[model samples]
Target: MANSPQAKKRARQNERRFAVNKARRSRIRTFLRKVEEAIASGDQAAAAAAVTEAQPELMRGVTKGVFHKNTAARKMSRFAARVKAMGS
Candidate 1:
């Protein structure tokens, strides 16, 4: 349906961007899942390490426009708190 050349170009660009963003989102989710699994296993040390690894990925998602700043901050805060509480 992109009759104009500009529109066709934009559609192509969107497809490429969509693929990149999807990969980024999947990578972030994988990191988050690792943290969740570590937490569920009740291994505080492993959870902490996983959280440490995930923090930057989440922030990177925010910087890359995949996630909102506050959303990433909130996730980090909650995960950190949970990891800390696991030690107690």
Candidate 2:
């Protein structure tokens, strides 16, 4: 369907971008799952560490346009609150 050369190039670029974004999303999810698992296990220290590690990864996702800024912020806020609540 891409008759024009430019369009064909764009389609190819889109495929590459899609793969890169997919990998980034998968990596981000892996970090998120680590935090969730740590939190579920009720290991405060591990949960705290996991969240700390995930925070940067989430922000990186936003910077790379994989996630919206507020989405990452909300996730970080919720995770932080939960980790803090575990203190008591």
Best candidate, lDDT = 2
In model 1, residue pairs whose N, Cα or C atoms come closer than 3 Å (at least 3 residues apart or on different chains), thus clashing, are none
Q: lDDT of all predictions, in order shown? A: 0.96, 0.98
Write candidate 1's Cα lDDT for 1-88 as tens digits: 8999999999999999999999999999999999999999999999999999999999999999999999999998999999999989
Question: For model 1, what is the error of residue 63's alpha carbon versus the real structure, in angstroms, after optimal superposition?
Answer: 1.1
TM-score of 1: 0.97
Residue-level lDDT tens digits of model 2 in 1-88: 8999999999999999999999999999999999999999999999999999999999999999999999999999999999999999
Cα deviation at 60, candidate 1, in Å, is 1.0
Question: How big is the positional error of residue 12 in model 2, measured in Å on the Cα after superposition?
Answer: 0.3
Clash count, one per candidate? 0, 0
Which sections of candidate 2 miss by over 4 Å?
none
